[model samples]
Target: MMTNAIIPLVYGLLIGKSNDDYNQFFEKLFEQDNFQPESIMTDYEGGTIKSVKEMLPNVLHKAVWRQVQSKGLATKYREDESFRLKVKKLIALAFLPVDDITTAFDLIVDEFDEEADDLLEYFGKTWIGEPKRRGTGRKKPPSDHKL
Candidate 1:
């Protein structure tokens, strides 16, 4: 899909939503040299993000703000007004310098403690790609099953 200042410029409806589907969409788009865009805003779809990075490595990728907020509503903190507000702040961290986003994110997570533990884990794993580890801070032992 392509847009110009919020107006849809072009788009394609695909039967499947997969990395390959997105790849095909973007690959075809690249055929037009003028299709290169400055930035792209989209929902946090893993396949779309991966395809976008692979196809338009130079273009900035951003999450759609409203969609991001809606995700927070589905998380564990849904009922807490304060938590919701904090999440909005957390999402706004994208506006900060890249180097500062992680520290600020951690601070917000720490403030909620157990209440936001699940949400924190989701954010860390999905967005930050934080490595999973044991509570002791040690890496898990390798699986015993043979390949």
Candidate 2:
């Protein structure tokens, strides 16, 4: 479901999960002519991401934290309970303000050893994106894509 509110509005449901299915959904959605969305939240589906970028240029897109957490647990889990706790904190960075996210992430990375570096790098580049620049000029509003 594509949601603009806490209770997401159902966009479309398809029998098959494919790029064409997503494209069809978006095509029907845009047919309304007044369905401009400021931002969109999705799980880590490559096809969905591609479709959203192709169909809704300039829309802000973010990976849902629940999906990211499960992915991290599957890929980066360790026997140490403390390490698991740290990874949980890093995963929770999705809730942080754009300005504070990068610094908080770096601190967590520093606390962990090289074992989690790949996970951290993936989170940094794919989810948090580059740190937002602090300056006075017409700063671009931060989003998942452009930091």
Candidate 3:
């Protein structure tokens, strides 16, 4: 079961062994009364990201990452000018702290334009690093491709 919460106002239980299971869980939550939420912050799990995008299309989804000691592999890549810049931009986008999506995007743009290297590095080390994947293997494809 995957649980998501927003303090006193909102909390959700997403019971599932697979992506479809959680998708159904979220669908039911949306149907239920008193379940509206402004935004959701979650670990950078790909399935959760896809489910949130499909189910809560209107809600703000922020990917959260915890600080961890780096293996210095990222630093090795830092020597490559283009790769460093790309990583810096992505890291900035991933780490900007804001209450909502708009502010987060704004911060990312501002930092990117200003070339805030320190901020980008801090974000890279803490939040913008590679995400960990959880759960089982991929789901079976739907019979029809066209919607």
Q: Could you tell me every candidate's TM-score relative to the true structure?
A: 0.40, 0.39, 0.34
In candidate 2, position 127 carries an lDDT of 58
Runs in model 2 deviating more than 4 A are 1-78, 130-147
Q: After superposition, how far is residue 100 of candidate 2 from its true place, in Å?
A: 0.8
Q: Please give, for residues 76-127, the per-residue lDDT of candidate 2 as tens digits.
A: 4445677667766775665577677766877887888876666666666665
Candidate 3 wrongly placed segments (more than 4 Å) = 1-17, 63-147
Each prediction's whole-model lDDT (CA): 0.60, 0.63, 0.47
Whichever of 2 and 3 has more TM-score, that candidate is: 2
For candidate 2, list the clashing residue pairs, or say none.
none
Pick by lDDT: 2 or 3, better one: 2
RMSD (Cα, Å) for all candidates, in order, is 11.0, 13.0, 14.5
State the number of backbone clashes in model 3.
0
The sequence of per-residue lDDT tens digits that candidate 3 reaches over residues 18-131 is 568668767877787877676766555556655766676545323221211142334434465654454444534423333342344335545343334554445434443322
Query: Which 10-residue window in model 1 sums to the lowest lDDT?
Result: 138-147
